[model samples]
Target: MTTETPTPLVDFTAAAAEARAIADAAGVVITAVDEVTAARRVNQLAERVWGPGVGTAVDLVTALAHAGGVALLAAQGTAGEPATDVGFALGFLGWSDGLHLHSHQVGVAPEHRSRGVGLALKLAQRAVCLEHGVRLMRWTFDPLLAPNAHFNLARLGASGTAFLPDFYGQMADSINAGDRSDRLEISWRLDRALPSKRPAAPQANESLVLEADSRGWPHPTGEPLGPGCAVEIPGNYSELRQLADPRAPAWRQAVGETLAGAFAAGLTVAEFRNSRYLLAAPHRP
Candidate 1:
């Protein structure tokens, strides 16, 4: 017998009008939803894309399907079967050519996970963005989740752009009820520079520490940092991971706004030191 690669069954950028129709064509059905309610579908966008709930935590999208708000990628399992919905969308912070953000949902139905659906969907999104000339795609995820780390950094091809400890603060949801949600901000710098492939393996006992290499970390939310008594910050510092707190909205809001600000200022992450995954900044001084 011979085997051939499968093609993406649906186009996320092309399915803004009929979400359910897309699902029906994909052999996956959102049972309770029949008539299209923008509000409800928007909420689905928020929930399903919560990849961390499945150990691949991602952030909340723009909450709508405006021209650039969000989208759905659907597919059918078999002939005469309902289309299975498996993709999500993203948006730009403002009018910028190479800077934008996105959120997506990638998992097989309980019966289908461990299958290739997740990877298939991700590549589809990559196709949509690359086809449209999107230069960057960014999102947030919990770093504690190893599968996600391996997938984003290794599979789908993204890197840690920033780290937001306790990004979501706390949630009473079923998935994150008892754990502190520390997150890593990721970016797919779509260009000739970044490549999408897994590393051969974890480095062998290599010592790495991400030096401060700056005055101080940017905490634009200014949410109280006790006090600072020294000037001329050291080039190297050792700091432990951030405390996980549900009350920590500063991590996300501030980081999101400021990272967007840094990109506006022409700054990009230079590298990542593996020891603690310290996010390295461009040495533009």
Candidate 2:
């Protein structure tokens, strides 16, 4: 008889527990937002993260939660310490043929950012997905946002494959106002290990196709395109917005065109380094 290989076993139970412990250590408790009061807190949290007119209604949140979606909130300073809601996430099940989840929104309170609240919420989302037999999670984020790019692609092990231009038209929120809702659609495989970091791409003298000028406006740097290119973005676009820079629109168009052109030519984004997107051309067979 031919020898058979045994399947490797995974300890998801321990994994879930470990995720919970991480949130606890961060002084935040991640839990399902089922109660009416808790749902209201999430609504308020949405406002805090995105500004006025962006928060979901309590009724809608409750409806989605009752329909078995992943609606969770992060609260600071757990038991007997006068806790408060600092972050929240709203997501729903995907109806695709394969098991999938679509994370619609995840936001952390401004004061509570950089405190592991967002990471905690994501880990909790993974646990909920596993319970529902979902193996794939999809989400969309603005491609110009550097921190978000790093978080989704590097920290959370998500990969982006598609670029959507003006996906939501003009958003009313303060954060997205005066900007096109260009998004990079990303996918995360819940069954796999969290990648420590994006693997380094092959060494090359990549051309800088899109780069910021001295005033932080994006311009086409006079670099000859080769097998690869680099697209650099401002380290903080929020500050650019605050400055009301007249070149903001130009920057948007320039970056959008460069990315679209590269992607259309069958180039893929390989890694994010030094706030630059390292793009690689398709390999010949």
lDDT of 2 by residue, 1-285 (tens): 999453233245744876798698778888898878888898999999889878988898998888888999888774577788889999998766456788999999999888778888988888888876777788889888899888887777676656788989999897998799988777777766666554655446777888888877788987755446788877777667788876666767887887777777767675676787777664332
Best by TM-score: 2
* Poorest stretch of ten by lDDT in candidate 1: 224-233
Model-by-model lDDT, in order? 0.42, 0.79
Per-residue lDDT tens digits for candidate 1, residues 1-285, read: 999453233334442223333344444433222223533443454455443333222223323344444344333356776545543333434333345646533444344444444554444445445556664677777554445555666555566666565667875554455455556667765432223343454445422221122343423333221111111112122121223432233323434454344444444433332312322344321
Clashing pairs in 2: none
What's the CA error at residue 104 for candidate 2, in Å? 0.7
